[model samples]
Target: MSRSRPGNGHRGLDRVVSRRRLLTGGAAATAALAVSGGVLGADLLSGASRPASRRLVESQPAAETAAPRQRTVPTPAPTSAPTPDPRYPDGPFVPGPDTRLWGVFEPGAPSNIAALAGVERAVGNPQAIHWYQSWSGPGSELDPVRLNNVREYGALPMISWEPAHAGWGTDQPPYALARLAAGDHDDYARSWARGIRDHGGPVVIRFAHEMNHGHFAWAAGVNGNTPEQYVAAWRHVRQIFLDEGAQNASFSWSPNIAYDGTTPFDQLYPGDEHVDWIGLSGFNGGSDLPWGGWLEFGPMFLPSYEVLVGYGKPMMITEVACTENGGDKAAWIRRAFTDALPNVMPRFQVVCWFNENVLVDWRVQSSPSSADAFVETAGTWRQRTP
Candidate 1:
């Protein structure tokens, strides 16, 4: 929640850290966290989240000649069978850590990555602070030398919002989804939803995120526009920033990673009563399964987000990645936050890491032995359980 880049005195602080990365293959079609105190009973729902079975977990694979982005989708049941009734939400899930894990860069590279040691031999996980480079300029618009090459090579500028049929990168058909479901939002969805409706701050407009397992093009999603019409187009872009009075911003529905037991998180629900949090899009790549360290693989997707646990809201991973560029994949980043981040940090609240580090020629750069195991898994992943 910081700001001040207007003309460049450069104070900066509109912190909406829950990131939403990916554009080519719109990132492995799905995702995969959260926290809070009190209100936890029910003798801990069979030891907190466990229903979706047969866990496999891997990302960015399936190439032979269909490499525009792949992982086709198949890895559900880490736990989710819900239906014993009694309107759910019990005990023992203890949860903590409301999402924000960082990474994703390419704002017109120049490398001095804040000072550059050969930009860590070419992007060896430089702790990123958002750099997917959308729209480019105006208002929340940033580029001060790519925000000083993301805080001089360590990592901070977050941006990713598109969904008037995704436009800027192209997707809005059906007569621009019938003029944004009859409300008529244009100008590229009013320049990323009118800079958070007018300017309340903390921007992270994650729209049409993983649309229930399709490759890209915002799924053409329908139920007669009844995923509540994508939660009423995110409550009409959160009521056009509360009727143009404008106030920063916050809205993420992101999907993917449902480990198919015949697919049904309510056909990718955008209605947990109009979401405010719950984002899961994972990545581990390098195969051979098992990557427990990034919070011990967060119990492989906590039984498929127990069907959005009665909408108590607050969960993130908005977007994530590993590589098609291959091997040693930064030694699976400290067992994924020291052992799958305590089984998805009790339904995560903030965990964003799409750190850019390509190999091929998406602009020439190569450094994978998984970047010295992602700097030793970001120094013991926030010292275990806090």
Candidate 2:
């Protein structure tokens, strides 16, 4: 998802006023602290206690010097076994025997099912193929041709259902969460659900993904969309799918890695009953833009992973990539597969790369080294088999 300057253009008059008050007051400070604790709790948990030397220094008076110079004593390592990774208390959520690989191919190019074949050719065969479609557009309807194509390739189809017109970067989006919650778009949602039911195969539906980002009109705090309205809208759509007997439709609730502290993601959650998978969008921009920096996978995602693991739902990195700029993209990709995914984030059931060249050169083949790194790293990880 694209980033934009924060605004309340889609908010109600009352909401805008309240938000302004919060921004100007102590409530904002409190919320910021709470967000910090939630996201960075894992790292904080380990180093929560101050060092003994610091504690001793603070306890001593400033006027009085220490009677004797305290000798530095090295602490011995623990003889006990190391604690297990808390991210998976009940063991990792392995859908099959291995992690699922998926992607959105050439997002800036034309929306064509045929383009996916090229993506598979570039990267190896993915366990799932992700594609996007707006509620109303040239490719609005759930195309059977696309679904079948993905199925024939022995991969599940993951659809990102944009609840607006196909026009990107438009100031005014056609659909709003408030209207959707009011049952205005029930027919459209139902029709799409019915199409999936008729397809007679499993489909992962990621609706209004990255809703925490203000760039999207459907995002909460935008377009008159409060957190409650977003949940209502989500349940409304999910219930319609259930009514249409789209039992094969697996719902994923995705939020961008909460780098922007505006939206509280916990409030936007529609509950475990409404969602099957918890999805996150974690990308490394690699110093291309002002917000961009050479961030490793752990720092970029570990905090968000800490928060999402508490949901107790299977997690998927629905969108992730590192730009080939100002750093070794190959090494970054290698670390993602070897260190982050397999070790730090073993609980994540699937990890999908955002294979697009939209904002930065995010494509795996942006450089020959990056391509080789991806292919080599991916080969070491076990992929889901159909």
Candidate 3:
């Protein structure tokens, strides 16, 4: 049965909408994960609906309009202020230099805990487990069981919380950035804020990430969204979380690599006070698609890194992956983990891998050589502490 809208007490009906895999093969059908009050977390993992398949989308570099800014480096920690959370002594979810961390995004996670076994087998347990949730009703419902499962697994939970429903690209209606800013979704927002606040554990909420890119509804210049609306919507939702006392939930305002045709990061940023971490979604398509060519990890992310670093906050690579079609994936992984992350981008406290076979096989284990490269680098990482 269809349910009432938020504020009417009944959450919307749990239903799957029709859509295809984005960015590849025209469009393939996929189901969003469904949650209900009666289901156990394990059952949700194993029995809940899963996407039938996924596609690959590469970050194509374009002619940047403006000159690149000078890159910024990490500075000394602040001397005194609010008592820091032990999990993130420096800032909200910010790992210290001695505690560099990496995370993974398997297609099946939060629900299907076993889906991470392959990753664990290759590189040991990740410091964080990444997942997604849409603003749609059932499949996107915030459940404590899901959060606890990740915590119990000895990893922090990072949620890519999109404001639009699954498969709904740039034209989400009630979820328009302005509508959100105007407080049309307060009931739903309040519910999630309270849920995470009450759970009382460290959680990373990457809200409407890659807003500088046009793939999603929240992105400016698409779906009638303006940069102002985007910032307003972000600040509005963040304030609601604060009002609910959701101190444990930290907001990561992520944007795409400021490639050609992407919006400027400055225009879209909600400001330092509104954001906890500066995040970026970058990938090396590596000749996987018709328009893609192999680009090294350094060049692929350096432009955006320089821009985001100036924000003076801890940074994270919210989404990153490389396809093995054209260049050496193993070599890329070794350089990224060993040289680039440790030496070049010391301000980046966390790196999350997009480990799925979506458009092209992006899994680190796509080849034996690539898997081994990751294992070697991963072992050297100093896992973050509480």
- Stretches off by above 4 angstroms in model 2 are 2-94, 97-99, 107-114, 168-174, 383-386
Go through the candidates in order and give the C-alpha RMSD of each one to the true structure: 20.5, 19.0, 14.4
Residues 256-285 of candidate 2: C-alpha lDDT, one tens digit per residue: 776645577778888767777777776676
Q: If scored against the real structure, what TM-score would every candidate get?
A: 0.29, 0.72, 0.76
Predict model 2's lDDT versus the native: 0.60
TM-score-superior candidate, 2 or 3: 3
From the highest lDDT down, the ranking of the candidates is 3, 2, 1
> Mind giving the per-residue lDDT tens digits that candidate 1 earns over 1-386?
11122322121212111112111122122222121111222222121232211110111111134345545887666576644322122211222342233343333332334333443454344332433322223333433454344423323234444332211222435423345556765454555455433322234445555555433334334322334455455566555644544333344566755543222446556454344556666554322223322222334445555555446666666555554333434444555655665454545534555433332212113354455565565444533444
Judge candidate 1 at residue 236 and give its lDDT.
Answer: 66
Error of 2 at 123 (Å): 3.1
Question: Number of clashes in model 3?
Answer: 5
lDDT of 1: 0.39
Q: What lDDT would each prediction earn against the true structure?
A: 0.39, 0.60, 0.65
**lDDT at residue 35 of model 2 (Cα atoms):** 9
